[model samples]
Target: MLATMPAAPSDINVLILDDNQFDRVRIRRMFESLEFGFHLSEVENLDGLDQNLDNKDFDIVLIDYNLPQGDGLEALERIQKHERNCNATTVMIAGDDQSQIAVRALKSGCQDYIAKGTLSTHRLRSLVLSVIDAAQASPTNTDDLHERLELLVSRVKEHHSSALQPKVAMIIQDIRSLRARVYQPHSPLAVELAAVEKRCLNLWSSLSETDAITLKAPKDVRVS
Candidate 1:
């Protein structure tokens, strides 16, 4: 019997890198079919990958070992460097079931490795959970800072439309003060949270100002 796995983390975001159009589509479909709660993003080339990394944050990265410009190892190296301050987990996806390549990927900082043809939703879910657990358990100073910012954002949203104008004003002041500290080079966690703040603000701005608020209990949201 196959081993059972826990549910996927609903808050985690995933980034997929694959040059082959067919493979990219198939992998995306698999993630979608699982019905797991994951935010999926994709890139077909190194340039695209860089741009995506700069614009949005991800919880995990799934990179195909054999990309166009260089092998997966090179890409992984670049990712590690670019994401040095990030806590995202990196997993190398390979077309060939090569033990040597898997070993090398691990040595090069990949959290895990999977063969594309044998990939399954259950396995993916498990890997993602493990990565998240690890990150939370031993977060860097930067990670802690981001967590604090997230809590602040959540609290602000909870009272965002309330009649308590003073509370909302205080929250806004707190956010602005935190934003100043976030730009310091020594504050990796603050910097990461700053980026997240910008993204969230952009998304919020895109939505209409008048909208009914509904509190729905969290449910498993997955993608294939």
Candidate 2:
């Protein structure tokens, strides 16, 4: 039996931070053309960004890599500091050749990054829909993380002898790094990511003791 695809959101509230008027117009036009309804509010500087960020319950925030009054990364950090807005999916917009900046933004916790030169209605629609779906599916409370962790740990135990274990190990390491790199240490998302990191570490430690998968545990920490 085929699984059903989730329905598109009927309405989406979007916050955009970009000082360039032309880019704002382009983004507006692209968003307006989408079949699903979206309400976009543009912020050209830090003051506007700070004001609307607190007042609006946005589903997504599109941040530009370049800003006149302050750095875009700084703006992103400010957004993370707001606990009420933590659920919003952030996407960074960068110049076509600004790959380094884009990588930094992604590592800093933006859900995704898009090149300004490649902006189009089709691409924008796809990215917005995907982010919205992920945001909608994400856990709204801490308890959900435990349920998810248990499921992941079960998967690890089941695949203990398979080649897929190594790939899963790599994913665990990435989650650990993500948890460490998060800006809002006390935010629900950060706490959840930390829980995942701890569980994966525990799984790897147990596997190491049993000599499973030829995977060597990190040497610095003693496995419990």
Q: What is the C-alpha lDDT of each candidate?
A: 0.69, 0.78
| Per-model TM-score on C-alpha atoms | 0.56, 0.59
Please give the lDDT score for candidate 2. Answer: 0.78
lDDT of 1 by residue, 1-224 (tens): 33433554346788889988887787777666656566888888888888888888788888888878877888787777884325578889886658788999998878899987678877776776687677657646988889899778666655563333333334444555676766575587777655655654444432213233243211321111
For residues 47-149, write the lDDT of model 2, one tens digit per residue. Answer: 9988998898888898998888777798889888887787677888999999998889989988888898888887777777687677677776789899899
Lowest summed lDDT across 10 adjacent residues in model 2 is found at 1-10
Shift of residue 112 alpha carbon in model 1, Å:
0.5
Count of backbone clashes, every candidate in sequence: 13, 0
Candidate 2 stretches with Cα past 4 Å from truth are 1-6, 139-224
Q: Model 1, stretches more than 4 Å misplaced?
A: 1-10, 83-85, 139-224
